[model samples]
Target: MSKYIQAIGIWFLIIPLAIINGGLRENILIKLGDIALLLSGIILSICIFVVAYLLIPKIKNCKQTDYFIFGIIWFILTNLFDLFMYISEGGGIKDLLGSYNFLTGNLWILVVITTFISPIVVSKIKKRKGEIKNV
Candidate 1:
């Protein structure tokens, strides 16, 4: 579905940003093996979210609100995890977290935040076509 496409698109955008940061420090995660792990995470996360949506079967009409919360949590946690991962790989957590230009970090941040948010956004399109649950 279009949602899956959108999800993959978001990953393509974010993964590059992560790779840039990861590679800037010569972090090993930017290499082929780690790249595979990263891709797998993104693809799997997307599939899980889609399946959750399909199986839940009864979302509240407050769809945007639900997704906003999910996106915020996901964004914060994803960044934090990345922060720590880079730290463990020999980069200073504070440096990586604090040294970036706001503009640059914001791109990756937005990519991450919106990856989770896209589901809610895409669902609105389907909801308009009456793909909604009343339960």
Candidate 2:
């Protein structure tokens, strides 16, 4: 139970990272044109993985399944947050759904997928390093 809570707390930390990433895309990466979206998505995914690698090991005694579940939870929460943001900004359902179209160069889906895998990937890395035990 505590581990789950800690996971959620760590996810909250990611919200700020996302905000900062978006800010960069808007202010700095905007000069890159359409490629900026792809770049920002990649940057955010790497940031997410780095965060998971640094924090997931601290949740002692986590099993492989636990890490997978954490990823699933974070993925779903991220999607929900995206939905809320879109709707709040007056975007229709179609707009939100359309953003997933890779043809448009919107790599948002990739970022979500990355979020869904980071925990599990980090767990494997930590286990290999013998940094995490009680698995």
Candidate 3:
């Protein structure tokens, strides 16, 4: 539907910003090491989820389902972008896939989980607040 399309559009806008943030984090990580990288990634994931939560409500006719769809689209597109960048930079498919190794390179998984759950969490928070206000 149109709402889903709009969600995709919004995601397109978000993707570039995320890539820039990721690049900056990667640079910082090289200097500060894994702990700093992991901590920064966790913090960034929280911030991204919060932003998505706040923005989702503003889309006209958006429902919980739409947010899920948006998350899915965003995730797929980001992975594709990563894949493209890897290949373009002369990296192999194995390396591209290995980047997902949870034991080593799992920070992205946090982002994935946050993206999927953010809408639901935001909806619940809003509902709880509404209930509290009414009572």
Candidate 4:
């Protein structure tokens, strides 16, 4: 239970990183035109991985499967949160779904995929290094 709490708590940290990334994308990366979205997605993906690498190992008694489950939870929650935001902003299904169109330079799908995999990937690395106990 505590492990679940800790894993969910880590997501709070990710939310701020994502907001900051959005700010950077809007303020700085936007100057780069169409590439800004892709670059920001890459940056956010790296940030998510870094956060997971630094913190997931601290989750007591978690195996790689637990980490993977955490990733799944985060992925679902992340999408839900985005959906809520879009809806709140007067966006309908099209607006929400449109974000996934990578051909239009929106890398939201990549970001979600990264969010869905970061914890497990980090756990694998930590397990390889013997930095975590339960594998």
Task: For candidate 2, write residues 1-135 as lDDT tens digits.
Answer: 589999989998999999999999999998999999999999999999999988988898777899999999999899888988989999866877887898888899899999999999888888888888745
Q: TM-score for candidate 1, please give it.
A: 0.44
lDDT of 3 by residue, 48-76 (tens): 67676666555665455656677777677
Cα RMSD of predicted structure 4: 1.3
Clash tally, candidates in order: 0, 0, 0, 0
For candidate 1, lDDT tens digit of each residue in 47-103? 445543553224444345555554555565566757777788787767555534344
Worst 10 contiguous positions by lDDT, candidate 3: 126-135
User: Could you tell me which residue pairs clash in candidate 1?
Assistant: none
Clashes of 4: 0
List ranges where model 3 is wrong by over 4 Å.
Answer: 131-135
lDDT of 4 at 30: 99
- In order, candidate lDDTs are 0.50, 0.90, 0.66, 0.89
TM-score of each: 0.44, 0.95, 0.75, 0.94
Candidate 4 segments whose C-alpha is farther than 4 A from its true place: none
Q: What is the lDDT of candidate 2?
A: 0.90
Model 4, residue 25: distance off in Å is: 0.9
* Candidate 1: stretches off by over 4 Å: 1-62, 98-107
Q: Tell me the TM-score of model 3.
A: 0.75
Which candidate leads the pack in TM-score?
Answer: 2
- C-alpha lDDT (0 to 100) for residue 73 of candidate 3: 74
